[model samples]
Each structure stands twice: as C-alpha cells, then as structure tokens.
Target chain A: MMEELFIALWVIMSILAIAMAIHAVLSRDLIKATILMAGVSLIASFLFVLLRAPDVAMAEASIGSALTAIILVLAIRNTKRFEEGGGEK
Target chain B: MMERYDIHRSIPAILLALLVAATIFYAFVEVGFGEAKVDEEGSVSNRFISNSTQETGSSNFVTAVVVNYRGFDTLGEVTVLFLASAGMGAIVSALPAGDKRKRPIPPSLILTAGTRLVLPLIILFGSYVFVHGHLSPGGGFQGGVIIASGLLLYLVIFPEWKAPHKALALSESLAGLSFAGIGIIGLAVGGIFLDNVISGLGEAGMLVSAGLIPLIYIAIGIKVGAEMTGLVARMKGGDA
Candidate 1:
C-alpha cells in the first residue's frame, strides 16, 4: 500500500513536471517562464526524495528552485520582462 | 531570415527532437531508472559502503564518501564555486551603475514582519543542517543555500538594503583558508591531505565522532554562505 502511494506520487509529479516544462517554454513572459521553471525544479526535488536521495533533494529544492529562481528574477528585473520586445516597468 | 513561422522548416526539427528523445528514452529504460547501477561486492561503491563507518566514523555514508574518500574533489568544487562568485562580482562591478529599481508599491507589512521573524530561524536551521551533516542527509551546500535564501527574502523585501561587503569577504576568506589549513594539518599529522586525523574523537553516532569531517563541513558552510550571499547582493546591483 505504501509502495502504491509512492508510485502514484511519482507518476503524478512526473506528469506535472512535463506539463510545467511545456508551459514554461510556451510562456512569452520571462518572469512567468522563470517561475514555471522553478516549479519544474521543485517537482524534480520531490522526485529526488521519492528516489531516496534526501541530500540531492535538499540541494535541488534550495539551490535549483529557490536560488536559481531568485537569480533569474533579478536578471529579468535588470532587463526586459517579455520575449521579443517589452519595456521594463 | 525566415520572417514568419514555417511549419515545413519545423517539421524536420520536430522529427529530429522526437528521434533524439526516443533514443534517450530507450537508453534510460535499459539502465533501469532509480536502481543502483553498481552493486557488485568488489566495486568501489561497495567498498565505501562497507568501510565508511569504521574508517570515517560518519553515520552517513554519503557524507563519508564525499568528505573523506573524495575530499580533494570537494575542495576543487569549493574552489570552482569561489571562482564563479568572484567572477560574477567582478563582472557586475565593472558594469555602469544603472538607475535604481523603484517598486511602485511598498512591500506588505506582513512580509516585512514575517521576514524579520523567520530570518533567524532560517539561519539557525541552516547551521543545524551543516553541523549535523555527518548524521543527517543535508550538508554544507544545502545549508549554505538555505542561509542565503533567508538573506534573499530580506533582499526582496528591501531592494535598497546593502550587505556589508567587507565583512562577507573577510568571513569567506577565513573560511576558505581554514578549509585548506585543515587539509594541510591532516597532511602534516596523518601523512595525507584531509585525513581523518581525529576519527576516534568520540562514539560513532555522536556529533563529535567524525573528527575533521564536521570541521571541514563547518568551513564549507561558512564559505558557501558568505559567497552565495555576496553573489546575490552583487547580482542585485549592490556595491560589492
């Protein structure tokens, strides 16, 4: 039963990751894309936990999702916010 | 340049991507995702698994392998991180000071108050993670990033706030020096760099048992925390 729940979560998270990746690519708003990419990293960290690598999971959650997201957001803040041509606010 | 989206031009690209994805999928299935790929009795991983506790006195084998068996590689990683952050600071500083970003609306009172309350807790938790690295799953890198995240929260709320650059650089230099110094000490006393000079300090499961492992991790934690905080501060256009 426990294993069943684990597999269910694994499948769900994998699907969510794929969906988020697609959305992140399709989104023209750079900030939105960055956030969706962070969501993907968050799901990847969850998948790491499911794979029983807690250390990797922690690193992924903190560095991949949080720090990378913040860095990308700061870059966006310094530059344009949208693809092609958009003025900074 | 192709002025508009051309389906004909993209069809080949799409097919190539699908073909590459299929090949990767086939390889991944063959390897059996999430399964241990090295389980042979005489394999290096097995050797580490068998001897890690007795040799290093670290309850966490991953920690033992990373901090003891492959400590030099870890040092190289630390150096790489330091160089990357240094380069970032140099590049950002060389750029012209742009107009300051002005947020139209002030940060919410809840966020400000909540950050003030949670910052200390985040810092405490980060230190705890690094301190207990040998016994637990997290180590210096994760802990350092967590600490930086706390500072990031404050930075987000207060865009004009500046980190004390001199203090951060001093702490970072001290931490880096101590890490290398410990390795040198191990070489002097134990005939090898980063040797477990005091592996028999205490009981195996206790905090002090892993000897130089904890100390090394502490240095790494401090160095990483300072470097990451400095990186983020400089990246935010602060005078580093």
Candidate 2:
C-alpha cells in the first residue's frame, strides 16, 4: 500500500514538473518564465531527495535553483523586458 | 494576450523539455526499481557495514566516504571553489569604475532592518555547523553557504556597507595558505599529503577523533566562506 502511494506521489510530482517546464517555456513574460523555471528546478531537487540522493538534491537546490534564479533575474533587469508589440520580430 | 512566438527559441525550449523528460523516464524505468537480496553472513554490503566502524571510525557512511576514502577529491573540490571565487572576484573587479555608479539602488528600510538583525546570528550558527560537521549531518558546504547567505543579506540590505577589501583579501589568502600549510606539514612529517601529522585518530566517536578531518574541514569552511562573501560583495558592487 505504501509502495503504491509512493508511486502515486512520484507520478503526481512528475506531472507537476512537466507542467512547470511547459509553463516556463511558453510564458510570455520573462520574469514569469524565470519563476516557473525556478519552481521546476526546486521540484526536481525535491524529487532527488525522494530518490535518496541528498547531495545531488543540495546542489540542485543551492546552485541549480537559487543561483540560477538570481542570475536570470539580474539578466532580466539588464535586458529588454518584452517586445513592445508582444511579438518577437 | 496571445502573441506570435519566435520559432527559433520556442523549438529549442520544447526540445529541451522533451529531452529532460525522456532522460528521467528512461532512468526511472531502467534503474530505480532494482533490489538485490543480501546473504545473512558475508555480503559485500554487509561486510562494509560491519567493518566501517573500525575502518573510518565514522558512523555516517557518507562522512567516511567524503573525508576518508575520497579525501583527495574533497581537496580538489575545495580548489575548484577557490578558483571560481577568485575568477568571480577578478571579473567583478575589472568592470569600469563609472559603471559601478549605475548599479541597483539599496533595498528599503524594512528589509535592511530585518537583515541587519538576522545576519550575525546566521553567521555564528554557520560557524557552529562547520565546527560540528563531523558529528552531525551538516558539513563545510552547508556551513559555507550559510555564511555566504549572511554576507549576501548584508549586501542586499546595505549596499553601501563597505566590506573592508583588505580584510577580505587577507582572510581569503590566509585560509588558502593555512590549508596548504597543513598539507605541507603532513608531507614533511608523514611523507603523505594531508596526513594527520600532529593529531592521532583517538577513540572512535569523540569530537577530535578524526585526525586531520576536522582541521581540513575548518580550513575549507573558512576559505569557502571568505571567498563566497568576497564574491557576493563584488557582484553587488559593494566595496570589497
């Protein structure tokens, strides 16, 4: 029963991860996309922990999610936000 | 509002997602479910589990792996961190002075006050974590990050809080030098790099029993903390 529950949770997590990845890719706003990407990375880190890879989870949470989010946010500030007409020309 | 997408960017993004999903699915299907039965008497896992207490004198298998079996790899990892920090510092230093004037303005009062109150205690706790890492789950990397976060808090809250550049440089250099000094001493005395040298392994579970492990960790913690703090300060355009 517990194994079944674990499998169910894993499936749910994977679905959420895929959904977040798609959202990150499709989002029009850079900030929103960045946030979605961060969320995906964080969820992936949690999955690593669930998989019993604590060291990899720590790296993912710290370097992958946090540092990448910060760097992307800073890059966003330095670059143009979005095309004025909402289309990439 | 729906907008026309750039096929160039969108295609790559979609492909990347697909690649990630495919890789994860493959791993889960191919690897994650395997389990092996162990013999009651003398399996490889059992032997290691039974004798690990005597071999490394560490109850935590991960700690034993990190500090004993793969000690050289840990040293190399520390070197990589040091190099990364140095590179970041050098790059940030090379930015034109006039460009510094255009950096982001300081965060507001509420943020600053809260950070100011919390940063010192966080740094203190990080030191404690590093000091006790061998005995607990925490380690140099965790503690280093904690210390770095404290410095980052300061940088965010007080953009103008000039980090004494000389002091940061001194601390970084000293830490690196001390690490090398310890290794050199080991080589001189024991004819092996990073050997225990002056300290003995003592009894198994005591605070000081790990010989050179604690000292190496302490050096790594200091070096990592200083480098991270320096990097954060430089990246934020604070005086370093």
Candidate 3:
C-alpha cells in the first residue's frame, strides 16, 4: 500500500538524518561538518513534503539547504583551517 | 582577568529551550481539549471545505488560507525576507574592498550556454506562478525563489556578472514601501488594515474576486525576487 511505502521512505530518511547529524557533531573538519549539516536539512525537507506540508518543504529547501550551504561555505572560508583531529573553534 | 562565568550565551539558550518546551506542551493540551468541541458541530474539516469558497473565491483551500485568512502573517514573512536582505547587504558593504579577491574564471561552456537559454523561461514561469497564486498551489514565495534561482544560475555561469546593484536596490525598496503603502491606503479608506478597497468581491470563482490578494502576491514576488538576487550578489562580492 501507499502508506507502507511512505513509512519505508520515512524510516530511511530518518536514519540518514540521524547519521548526518552524528557526523556533523563528531567531525573535526568544519567544512565537512557543515556539508553534513546541509544534508541533514535536505533530508528534513523531504520528510516535510512526505508529511503533506509542501509549502514548508519548499521553504526548507530554499532557505535551509541552499542559503545555509552558501553561508556556511563562506564561514568556513573566512575561519582558520580546522585542526586535523580536533573540533572547530 | 578572566570572567568566572560566561552567562550571556548559556542562560539565553537554556531559557529559549525551556520556553519552547512549555509552549509545545501547552499547545498539545489545548488541542486535546478543543477537539471534542470541534467535533460537536459536524466536524471542523467539513465546515472548512464548505465555507472556504464563500469566504475566499478560490477553490484551492491552501491558497485561500495563505492569501486571505492569514494575509497579515504573509506580510510579516515578506518583511522578514526584506530585513534579511538588507542585513546581508549591510554586512557585505562594511567589509574592506581591499580584502576582496578578484573574480574567478568564466564557468564551463555548457553551464554558460544552459544559463543563457533558461534564464528568460525561468523568469516567465515565475511570473506565471505569481499571477496564478490564487487559483493554484504556487504562490509569491515559490515564484520569488524560482526567479532568484535563475539569477543564481546566471551568477554561477558568469563569475564577473554583477547584478545591477542600484536598480535592484531601488526596486526592492520601492516594492517594500508600496506593499506598506497599500496597507495604509486600506486603513485610510476602510478604517482597517489590509482591507481591499479597490475591487468589490466579484462572483465567487472568478480571478478578480479575491480583492487585493493577487496584487499583494505580485508585490511580494517582486520584492522577494529583487531582495534575494541582491543578497546573493552581495555575498558573492564579499566572498571575492
């Protein structure tokens, strides 16, 4: 049924989201962490669409993913390089 | 000379989290209690479907909800976008020009050609979305972002391409001011905010029946598109 498919997709997306969040929190490299965070946002947006809130999904895709990615890249460029095995300052 | 406690950041964050949790709990309890009352009169969903056409002229319930019932909220959302754009521009302008780097080389031929081919169609589609917001699922925000994406594509393809800053600035400012101006005009004529004064509520299901909703959406589309494009260009300059 369609409901089962929705559930499957939700589960997969939730796992990806958790993994990305953990990577973002654990990573020492600022740029890599930021990119992971962007992926988390993108997964969240997809979940929003699945939950029947397309408008919120659109906003999340535009602002949460695209704009946040650009801003984080800029931040990484401006900051000192992250230590190889330590968290970003 | 080190401070004993760094209270500024921790206290505010803890307070914000507590506030959010409390509000969520309150909303849950309120909804639980309200559901019975809601169901007493033949289900709230039916009432919504029945009354929507009468109230807003649009068959699409979501569009009606966004453009009419919550017009004030949409106004606030657009204002937030405007403020964000202005803030980004201000931050970029404050950076030292000497620290800015030279523009990067031209993008790939495919990207350049694709952008040139698609930009006009993107703009056209965005305009279509805005004009049909009252009748369909698309709205000002959707159209605005579409327009912004086209400009962003152009920026990516042509590294040296600078958005005409002065024109965009003027357009953004004027769109924002005119949106407020229309609201003020409504107050002057109808003695209330956002009251549609120019057009009478025509036959239900007509394009012109929503009074000023379509006009407001068009203004929002223009303002958001200009502001977002300006923000991207400003950030590009700052990065350079």
Give DockQ for candidates 1 onward, in order: 0.50, 0.33, 0.23
**Interface RMSD, model 2, angstroms:** 3.7
Candidate 1 residue lDDT tens string, B66-134: 899999999999999999999999999999876675554778899889989999999999999999999
C-alpha RMSD of each candidate structure in angstroms: 3.9, 3.8, 6.4
Q: Output DockQ, candidate 2.
A: 0.33
Deviation of model 2 at B5, angstroms? 5.9
Best by lDDT: 1
Off by over 4 Å in 1: A85-89, B1-27, B36-39
Off by over 4 Å in 3: A80-89, B1-49, B98-105, B197-209, B238-240
Task: State which candidate has the highest TM-score.
Answer: 1
TM-score of each: 0.91, 0.80, 0.77
Between candidates 1 and 2, which one is better according to TM-score?
A: 1
List chain B TM-scores, each candidate. 0.89, 0.79, 0.75
Candidate order by decreasing DockQ: 1, 2, 3
lDDT of 3 by residue, A1-89 (tens): 99789789999999999778765655556787788888888899899888766766766776677666776665566554463432224
Q: What share of the true interface contacts does candidate 1 keep?
A: 0.65
